[model samples]
Target: MANSVFGITDENGNFTIELPSWLHATPNLEKACAVKVIQLPLDSVCRLRHGPSSSHGIHLSSSEDGFRTYTTGWIQLQQHDTK
Candidate 1:
């Protein structure tokens, strides 16, 4: 596990999280933690992004049956709505 840089949580169970300088620049927090965009292709959102494209990474995808290149897990989950 990653070493905790900050102190423990308070009585209210609130703790401060100071992200890295690179994380601060990232717009999407979810994608920020997991994705790393190398050799950036045509992105509809970050087309005008500055600095090296390798600095940012693309989203990950997997096949349900381990055959296809792209996966629709999130979309399928949304459609099924098991909740």
Candidate 2:
């Protein structure tokens, strides 16, 4: 995963994460491991963390099998009610 800067979680519990300066400036940068955009059912929400610092990186355990990827800046995640 690409190195990421720190992020802030608002009082409303909304997280605002920023990509590294290089990635931000060049949105077309090829995918490394970091996710550019993701939308999951509230039920699917598990744990969120910055990738590891040493080597193994942050371990993400999820019930979902995997994710689908498309060209950068061209994908839109549809929002639906999980209830």
Candidate 3:
């Protein structure tokens, strides 16, 4: 199984996620597996809601409680990018 990496967005609403270097060096994810954005939040302190779901890999959902916009995206190996 692939190890999971986690990152929180900075004050500028930017986040950086890094995978094991071995993945690229060994090419373990070339075509056998895909890098995906987990749709579900593993752990959250505040209220959370499931927003709009993506048919492809990208997930665009909204926070109905505050009407705030929450965006999530995912990518699959050998697949076209989706917005």
Candidate 4:
């Protein structure tokens, strides 16, 4: 099981990573089943921290006529850095 990474678009059209519901069910995500979306400065580096066996991923979707549509792909989280 591996954690994944994902990106979301901000008001200014810039992209940021988030760990939404989709990521929770990932193979190794149970450890960090709860997730939060945090916003930072536009030029700052973003970081994701998780415990052992925790995973992160993202999904993109849209709703129309009471139905939801999703994109086909997801980002992958390969490793963690403890600094």
Worst 10 residues of 2 by lDDT: 50-59
TM-score of structure candidate 1: 0.29
Candidate 1 lDDT, tens digit per residue, 1-83? 26223434354433344655555455554344432223223432233234343232334354355332211122110122244
Q: Give the Cα error of residue 35 in candidate 2, in Å.
A: 6.4
What would the per-residue lDDT of candidate 2 be over residues 1-83, giving only the tens digit for each residue? 23655544354434445445565444434434333323233663332342223122222233244332322222233333357
TM-score of each: 0.29, 0.25, 0.31, 0.19
Error of 4 at 49 (Å): 16
Q: Provide the lowest-lDDT 10-residue window in model 1.
A: 70-79
User: Each candidate's lDDT (Cα)?
Assistant: 0.34, 0.37, 0.40, 0.44
lDDT of 4 by residue, 1-83 (tens): 25545466566534544555675455643344433334434554543343334434334356588443343343222333448
Candidate 4, residue 71: the lDDT equals 38
* Candidate 3 Cα misplacement greater than 4 A, ranges: 25-46, 51-83
Ranked by lDDT, top first? 4, 3, 2, 1
**Ranked candidates (TM-score, high to low):** 3, 1, 2, 4
